[model samples]
Target: MTIGIEYLRVVRERFAVLKGQGDKTFAQLDEEHFHWTMNDESNSIAILIQHISGNMVSRWTDFLTADGEKPDRNRDGEFKMKRMSKAELLDCWEHGWRVFLNALESLNEHDLVKTVHIRGQAHSVIDAIERQMAHYAAHIGQIMFIGKQIKGEEWANLSIPKGGSDAYLQRMLKEK
Candidate 1:
């Protein structure tokens, strides 16, 4: 495959991995736990979801034709604490991901070299994609950290457990 095709495939795989981590974290949390916060200034999982979803929608819709930051986006409002049911939160999450993944799927090799705008700043399509990938990954990390903090000892391991590296390696070898 060409480099552009390979890059796109790799980017999609990385995004899928990030989303899987988020899904696992969400599964381990109760509705109430989604609102848990470290302090008044800190964001809860719900707030993070709101912010991430809002960002995804704004940045991905008309990704190449229009500026990434939509005119109607309430970037500041996303950080405000709002009480939403777990179902509502998940719906919001799904909507954002749908828009984002669709946009990513629609790109072609030629489009990679095209320019896009975010907040009036110019970026090549590849650079724009990398920017969003980094942004989403950072937020996902925050979600995972918050989930782990609330679940504490009850949190299911997302990757190898503290001392399971040898066993995990052995299992992989066996599979091979």
Candidate 2:
């Protein structure tokens, strides 16, 4: 694969890591937790998921050939609360990932440097992907943090537990 594609792959892998963390975090959370906005200013997980889905659909639909920000996208409304079941939330997540991966799969080496407009700002295809990767990762962190806070003691650590890095490193070294 080309360097640009490889980087996109890395971004996707990081997304997988976040998705796994989200799954664990939301496992015990119900529809109540998914839709619960902490306060008037705070956003719920459901809203975030919807925002991401909209983003993926707009940005990745025509992807290389069109603007990343589609005319039909309602960016402001993405923050609005939407009622959803756990199954529905998962479906939204899956749909976004499918669209994102499909766009990634269709990319060619030459498309990396191609310019795409996001909200009318120009960015190279690779840069655009990188920018959104960071954007999504930030939200994933928020989702995981919120999940941990809500689940408290019941929440299992997604990564190694406190002070377990030595053992984890040792195991990785042994495998290598």
**Candidate 1 lDDT over residue span 1-176, tens digit each:** 89999999999999999988998999999999889998999999999999999999999999999999999999999999999988899889889999999999999989999999999999999999999899999999999999999999999989999999999999999999
User: lDDT tens digits, residues 74-157, model 2?
Assistant: 989989877778899989888987898788777777888889887788899878888887888888788887877787898788
lDDT of 1: 0.94
List candidate 1 stretches off by more than 4 Å: none
Clashing pairs in 1: none
Q: Candidate 1, TM-score vs. the true structure?
A: 0.97
lDDT of 2 at 95: 90
lDDT for 148 in candidate 1 is: 90
The whole-model lDDT of each prediction reads 0.94, 0.82
Query: What's the distance in Å from true for residue 84, model 2?
Result: 1.5
Which candidate number maximizes lDDT?
1
